[model samples]
Target: MRTPTRFKAGAVILSAVALTVTACGTGGGDTSGGATADAGSGTGEIKVWGHQGEEGEVAALQAAVAGFNSSQKGVKATLQLIPSADYTKTVSATSPDQLPDVLEYDGPLMASFAYDKKLAPVEGLVSAQTIGNQTDSVKTQNTYQLDKKLYGVSMYDSGLGVYGNKALLDAAGVTYPKGLGDAWTADQFQTALEKLAAKDPDQKVLDVKENYGGEWPTYGFLPIVNSAGALAIKDNKAEGNLNSAPVVKAVQQFAGWRKFVDPNSDDKAFTDGRVALSWVGHWQYNPYNKALGQKLVVLPLPDFGAGTKSGQGSWAWGIGGSSKNGKAAGLFLDYLLNDSNVTAMTTANAAPPGTKTVIATDPLYKPGGPLQLFADGLSKTCGANPPTTACVATPRPVTPAYPVFSQQFSQAFLNIYKGGDAQAELDKAAKAIDQDFTDNNNYTS
Candidate 1:
């Protein structure tokens, strides 16, 4: 959750590797002692694994683990941090019995692990209140519950929006949106871009982060497809849905904005004042706020016919399916989701809190707060269904085939943004995704 750029490759590779690796069944063994004993037991140690994130992230996580370890007795918790680049490889290579009792994973990849039976259901194990308190978007991300069962949970969630320079917009006679409800229409947005470009020294009005090229295109631009009332997948397939008229039209409109975009190769277009608007995530808040101070303003992405939409979901926690200490692991999860801990993690990451209580109290996300638009957008997620006009926050497709879907869609975005044929590239992407889903038998056993 530090940023998509850090761990995208590992997650992409994890799913492909998972499909080839033999599915491992539930069992128990000790990671430290190598003993044939249940680590999930009340008295045994609970080993936790998480991605080594940014400096603040690492410090916050260590503090949380330390707090949990000292809070009580009986079950001791130890955390092991894996470098982001190697997190997936380590999980793929480890034997199930040797895997940590508590594992941290990206939200979208939960389906791949749940389908492989690598994670256990969290419903009865974690408290009813804990699960119930999570944001609707969090529930959608964590649950492999299309079968009606819970699996994973996260401390915080991710979102996307437009960051505008107030002075720049004002000087250009451009009106910025107050919130999601008043988000600019596609034409209005394009007009604003043109106006801002005229005022900008470099004539680059937007930074869509073309440099952070892994899972970002899918995370940041899928809203363009979703806002147009189109989806990348439906009924477990991508053929007709992805290559449909609305999707192509939406993508074409996005490509039309290419001339105003800053290549952002050096990643300083927005921060350095070369660009007036940056289409990015919450992780950029501190830097953007620091640079502009009173001039920085956050707004929802433009409405693309249907409504203003954004993407949601981030790193979450789960109990390993093979751990015998489900109760102990659940306790740790419950501890992590408590208001204080949730605030700690979300504050460190500058992400939206997973729980309602923290969001209500958080200065950055409370009503009329600078980042409230993100919370409002996340509260109206489309869940596992296709998005509609009313849906504003759409999670990535919840399917084991997501890795393939993301890869293909991202490549199509790059090609289309570079002036490739939108329809042709999307059709090629749709076919490749469908082939992967077919090869896996729609991921249905």
Candidate 2:
């Protein structure tokens, strides 16, 4: 079942070199492949591809295309919505000639496509001022450069934070960790967790949702590592970074959290009083608040000696180099990025809006709104803030090897959760990743 809200960004896990072949060829628009005309020749059907979601999401996309077809006379835009699970697979499986003109991709993989020359130059399609107007999250996650050209742009950003059972904190004589301003310190957070464990010996203190595999480990657990004063990945590699002293110490402490947390994978653990906090995405806002009522409060992750690291970057769109109609495809993509369209899509999914203009105007995203804390947290971690001894919004690693890296890191994290050595497992994962890098010539990044 596709969770309409699951930002299951493209699961581009295929590691074989063969995958790149399908994504690239001797093309115009930056890549070496069938030379593309200077612009959309017009009159040809412009195929747009995106992952399927809720009815409203589907409607929003269809409505965008309908508007495009109606507004233009020569180029007719058509949206082909693929199942969420098959999105990346379908893209990878398509031959160069069969690829979509415009593709909606998960924010993180933008660089991967650009690295392989699968996407076309984006700066030429849109203005620098237009790209500059995007949110920090979009700037960090969506845009990429290859050789010398900029390749992609994000349509929106998403939010991640913790849901607290306020009663659990109060009854344990602990003050709730507020939003970014009063986020708990590393030591304070652990003390609070300990207090909760002492109060209800059988209950868990934290739920980072490790059981829902795929990108959860990298997306969910990586913040703790970053918050500990080190990155989980750096410059498209993880050797020294993932196994750095700070990361190792952080993982060691997280292992201690196991004794305080219940193994249950359900979010209801908080509602049932089986847990005190659930580190989760903003999508949990309504249901979690509904369950916990006035006792619920959302908070940023504790600053683990360094700074809090909240995730940004969600889904985004870009034009493929294989498109015969780059101009028409870019038009459709830009239409989808318009304020009204962005508002509709994000509001339907209860996600944070991506652009500054949209975020400023959206009621739910305004300061003091129900999800403002989530939006604020994302700003600090992945936004324009610089990382040093303070909290910051960090972008995911830029390697084309992410799918394979995500898999190994997930296993390593699971091993640590199950009482394995953090350093050993991380090193093992890094070794495996480096080996794949050597095997594929680092995906020619």
TM-score of 1: 0.92
Task: Summarize candidate 1's per-residue lDDT along 1-445 as a digit string, tens digits.
Answer: 2334453212332444543342221222111111222334565688899998767778888888888888888778899999866675576567666777889877777776666556667876778999989988889887763464667787888878999988888989998899878999999999999988888777878988877756687888988888888777887778888888888988899899989999888888878888889998877887888889999999999888888999898888888867888788888888888998888887877888989889887888888778888889988998877777677898888776776787788889889989999999999999988987676666665
Clashes of 1: 2
lDDT of 2 by residue, 191-221 (tens): 8888888888675678776545566667777
Q: Which regions of candidate 2 are displaced past 4 Å? A: 1-38, 127-129, 145-149, 381-386, 443-445
Lowest lDDT block of 10, candidate 1: 25-34
Q: Clashes per prediction?
A: 2, 12
Supply the TM-score for candidate 2.
Answer: 0.88
Candidate with best lDDT: 1
How far residue 385's Cα lies from its native spot in candidate 1, in Å, is 2.4
Q: Ten-residue segment with the worst summed lDDT in candidate 2?
A: 26-35
lDDT at 28, model 2 = 28
The predictions' CA RMSDs to the true structure, in order, are: 4.6, 3.6
